[model samples]
Target chain A: MHELSLITAMMDLILKDAQSRGIRKITRVELKVGEFSGAYPHALREAFAVASRATPMEEAELVIEEVPAELRCRECGAVFRPSETGWACPSCRSQNVLLQGGLELEIQSYHGRDGDVGQGRSRQGYSSGEQEES
Target chain B: MSVKVVVGKDILAVNRKRAEDLRARFKQMGIKVVNMLSSPGAGKTSILEATIPRLQKVRAAVIEGDVATTRDAERLSHLGIPLVQITTLGACHLDASMVWKALEEMDLSRVDLLFIENVGNLVCPASFDLGENLRVVVLSVAEGTDKPAKYPAAFLSSQVVLINKMDLVPYTDFDLERVLGEVRAMKPDMKTFTMSCRTGEGIDRWAEWLEKWVRESQ
Candidate 1:
């Protein structure tokens, strides 16, 4: 499955990030998987288990957040989730709509073992766009 | 005393960056690359087989991707055009790195058009950008009409869609109108070509359009 390759590539990133931060053990990995991103959550979890075997992230828990697919109406600028009746906008019935969301695939954060909150560490190679410490 | 640190990195950011770099390289080199994606047995190779002979006016090459076979490369190499095969062994899609590596094995200096035939899958192939000038999704009549709706990502990101196996449309229950309707729902301006390689029904039109694209890229 493609999930296996995806998982392997993700682990490589995780390992590289962990190494840079001098984090020996990863407690958890937080990810966001959009509904339209084409990666099934269950399949990703299964692939993670198989890909992380005997690795530094083997004991890590995988946490995922699902984002709903959203569309924007071209005619009226209406933002709405996918409709059951059709893809027509709820605010304005327009077939000329564009996808605005549900294609996100991001690794938001990770919990590293035995690290202090504010001060105790080496130069943690934290490479996230959001520098907010969870 | 575990610390929860915010990384906020796109998981695909690295791959996307690589693809972007490759895109820049292609642009600087003035190579028109096409990434063709489809489901297994959707006639990607067959389309190339039929289209290449007619593309004599354009200098073309192909990089074939598959899970575990070089048969496709073997087939295209016989055409006497520069072609290479990247067998993923078990991976379902071709990523930017694989293509970047494949480039080192071939000579693309005088290549006007480069077609990368991705692994035959509707889902994962859409996620990875392989630095192509155009993205073409091929769907055959035998695959049914609901594919565009079911696999919106592939159809949504494509520039031109090739409706293959039209010769079998009369024999199968596939509805061309329904498929096109769904394709329009995803992308209103997507260019489409309906043809069957078995009968060479609409290859000439496709070849002309592709030749125009190649010329425009140059």
Candidate 2:
């Protein structure tokens, strides 16, 4: 499935960020996956474990946030959450609503050890890359 | 061990970027490009065979992508249009790099419409953008009606869905209504047309759409 390839891409991005910031370990990697993004979260989790082995994210916790599908009504310009049945604008009852978001598959943050401060700034502390714990 | 974290997002982002570049190039040349995606045996080739004759005045070109065999390319070549075959050598989809290569080798200076027939796989091709303005997906009635639900990625990504092989609907127990419903459920606004490329019924509607697209693009 395409999820295997997506997992590899995610890992590559993680590795680049860690190397650039000089972060020693990644305790958690927070991600937001949209409901209509065509990505299976369970399959991605399993694939992430295998692909991240031996990397700094090996012991990293993956926090997957499932973003519901949303649509912005073309008529009223109101944003509404899409239900499982269909996408409809709640404000104006318009079917001409364009997609507004929720298809996000982004690595919001990575937490573990904070990287060294740059540009002679004070240390940002452990919360620098802090992800939402719960 | 410092964890260098990067978020590449979709694995096909680079491919998409390349496709966009190709799109810009096509626009500069004033060409109407259509990216065709579908499952195997959806009569994609047959649709092409039926379409080329209708577009004789438009001067179209085709770029065929497949894992192996030049059969599709050969068939398109027989139609007397410039055709190039890009063999992925086992890859499930055609990426932008392959299309770039095909564009370089083909004499498309006079070509008004470029039809890029992608490798016949419902899953992977949806993720990759081939730099075409319009994406057409063909679904044969011989396949189950549940295909749209099962393969939402392709249907959702496509602008038009051609329900092919309508002639077989009578002989088989395929539910045309359910299939159309499923497709509409996934993409509520997608333009769909039911046709038999074999019998040449409803080919004119598809051709008219293509012609309108070309005229508008120009």
Candidate 3:
């Protein structure tokens, strides 16, 4: 499905990040997927495997943090997460709750060797927004 | 060995930002953009084809989105209007970034009305905004009337619900009243139009309403 496309986009960012830090190999890639985002994690992993072949992230481990569904009550100022069934604010018990968050997907960080680390191989402070890529 | 990272950023937030920006641009240009969404085989393309003839007087352009086909654009091209085809490769829904790229490629200077036909799906498309003035959801009777109840988000977010394939109502057992009730349950004030692109029945009312809305928005 679209997971493959999303996986490709993620890999593009990861590869770019990995190359920028002069990293030889990627150990792990942390990601946060939201509940309402409709991204299938299993499919994404499968897509990642295909997209990561022969790259610095060939053996990269994907760590996904699934964010659950959350809603905000319109009647009351109560914010809560939805249960297994449908959306009903847990705090104020209102059905007229608007969805607030949990729909997210991001590349958190990666662990790998960034060339020689001076006296000690220290972890690099890597972030997508902080880096500019052409 | 091991690393723990926290990425609390929202991926869709980026798209939403772009969609908002596009909406602002559309408003400034006085373009009445309509982002149309529906399930596969829901008559979205057909409705667009039907709507184009009635929009002859208006300077309208179509931005067709699909997984990997230019057929929809080809269909609209027959109407002799500016059309841009966006192939998503494999994405289920069309996001704002792709739309921004497509919009940049299209001739938007003289366009009064812009129609963006999203990839056919009632689920994923609801979560993404394509910077349209109105999000119209098409529901054909052949698909069943219970769709509004099952997929409330699509119905709730839509400004107009075009109930298409009304001519097939004779063959199918779709309850028009029940579908209307379901849509009203979620959105009590939603406007709906029932028509068939095949027979071109009841298309004028929809076209008239759309024209009025476009004029008002401009």
| Backbone clashes, each candidate | 1, 11, 0
- Residue-wise C-alpha lDDT for candidate 3, range A94-121, written one tens digit per residue: 6566656665666666666544423232
Best by DockQ: 1
TM-score of 2: 0.77
- CAPRI-style docking class of model 1 based on DockQ: medium
Each model's iRMS: 2.4, 6.2, 6.8
lDDT of 3 by residue, B1-218 (tens): 23233333444455667899999999888788999999888898998888878974678899998988888888778887889999988788898988899877888888899999999988778767888889999999989867865565567678889999999998999999878865664455789999999999989899988988888767
Quick one: best TM-score, which candidate? Answer: 1
Give iRMSD, candidate 1: 2.4
What is the TM-score, restricted to chain A, for candidate 2?
Answer: 0.75
lDDT of each: 0.85, 0.77, 0.76
DockQ of each: 0.58, 0.18, 0.20
Rank by TM-score (best first)? 1, 2, 3
lDDT of 2 by residue, B1-218 (tens): 22333342554556667998999999998888888988998999999999989974688999999888999988777788889999988877887888999987899888899999999989778777889899999999889677775665687789999999999988888998777766665567899998998888999998988888788768
What class would a CAPRI assessor give candidate 2's docking?
A: incorrect
